[model samples]
Target: MKVIVGLGNPGSEYAHTRHNIGFEVIDYLSEQESIRLTKNKFNALFGKGKIGDTDVLLVKPLTYMNASGEAVGPLLHFFKLDTADLLVIQDDMDLPIGKIRLRQKGSAGGHNGIKSVIQHVGTQEFARIKVGIGHPQHTREAVVRYVLQGFQGDDRAAIDAAIERSTSAVKAWLTQPFSQVMNMYNSNK
Candidate 1:
């Protein structure tokens, strides 16, 4: 079984924020599969279903962004799933807008959610897809505010495109190997 976790804060206030891109992707995937994320477990909102023969659990950690690791660790233990069977989707402020990057294993690059997951899992060997939200032109505080806020105009369109691409990429990842999925979707050129 594969567990696909999308990192973000919960609640309507954060619904359209750049930080909630992870949640947006997962929600799109759930809708495509006609699955409702009604199951609450391991400090997360999730649902179970098969995606192209791969048993999948779509998750949105209710532990919020920073402490996401706490929920992921226990859930993996309960399900007897290894790091290899996990995939995380999140927004990246460092990348240029509209770009997507997939990595098999790496550091969090200062993302608190990924940092927490690493701390709990005790490894960085999980697969991940990062949706670019672009960095702010001004100070760090501006970047924080921008991400926590919401996307609009062309930015919203980019986010929507990313979600559509992520749905395809994730479904491909479940059935095919990581390399294949990366080759097909992880492109900026």
Candidate 2:
């Protein structure tokens, strides 16, 4: 079974924050695919279904952002899943808003949540789909505030479009080869 894990803090206060973009996309996917991510398992909000013919499990770890690996590592072990069978979705501060990038493997780039997963799993060989949340300016405080804040006006529409693109990207990944998915989705400028 393939697992798609969306990383974010769990709470209503974080519902619309840029840092919760992963949660938002997962929520969107669940809604569009008619699956309910209500099952409480592996310390996560989860739903099981299919994308095309591929059986998939959608997971949003409830251990919060930084400690996300605690939930994912056990789930992977329980399911006897390889890193290749996992796709991590998270918000990226590097790229501009609304863009998405897919990578087969890489460093976390200072994302504490991804770092935690890498530490627990002892590998960086998993796949990832990063949705850009746009970078904040030079101010340190602004950077913190930017990620924790919700999108407004046009940014909301852009975010919605990105989520839709992510769903299509997942379908493509399941049906086509990883190289094709990478080629098609990596330069999502």
Candidate 3:
């Protein structure tokens, strides 16, 4: 089984914020595939269904972004799945808005959610798809405020497009190898 995790904080207040872009992709995938995220376990909301011929578990951690590993590590352990079976979708402030990048493995690169996942999972060798949110400023405070806020006007349109592309890449991952998916998606950048 393949486990797809989208990192985001819980609660309506964070619904469409830049930091919640991961959750947005999961939501889109769920709707398109008819996968109902009705199960709550390991502090996560998840659903299991078939994506093409692959068995997939779509997850949204309820422990919030900073502590995402609390849910992800346990879930993978309980299912006896390896990190190789995992795919994480998250937002990236380093890339321009609407861009998406896929990596087979890497460090968190300052993302608290990915850092948490790496900590609990005990490795940096897992697939991830990063949707760019664009940096607002160089200061830490400004970065925090920017990520937690919702996108506006043109930014919103760009984000919407990015989300669509992210979902498509995810579906492709279910059928093809991670490296192939990365090559297919990353070359567009």
lDDT of 1 by residue, 1-189 (tens): 999999999999999899999999999999999778999978999999988777899999999899999889998999999999999999999877767888889999989999999999999999999999999867878877898888889988988988898788888888889987898886545
- What shift in Å separates residue 181 of candidate 2 from its native position after superposition? 0.5
Which model scores highest in TM-score? 3
Please estimate how well model 1 matches the true structure, expressed as its whole-model Cα lDDT.
0.90
Candidate 3 Cα errors over 4 Å, as ranges: none
For model 3 the TM-score comes to: 0.98
Residue pairs of candidate 3 with colliding backbone atoms:
none
- The alpha-carbon RMSD values of the candidates against the true structure, listed in the order shown, are 1.2, 1.3, 0.8
TM-score of each candidate? Answer: 0.96, 0.95, 0.98
Q: What 10-residue stretch in candidate 3 is worst by lDDT? A: 180-189
lDDT of 3 by residue, 1-189 (tens): 999999999999999999999999999999999999999999999999999999999999999899999999999999999999999999999999999999999999999999999999999999999999999869989999999999999999999999999999999998899999999999955
Taking the tens digit of each residue's C-alpha lDDT, what string does model 2 give over 35-131? 7887897788899998778898899999999998988998899889999899889999997788899888899998988998898788999988899
Q: What lDDT, from 0 to 1, does candidate 3 have?
A: 0.96
Following a full C-alpha superposition, what root-mean-square deviation does model 1 have from the true structure?
1.2
Q: Rank the candidates by lDDT, best first.
A: 3, 1, 2
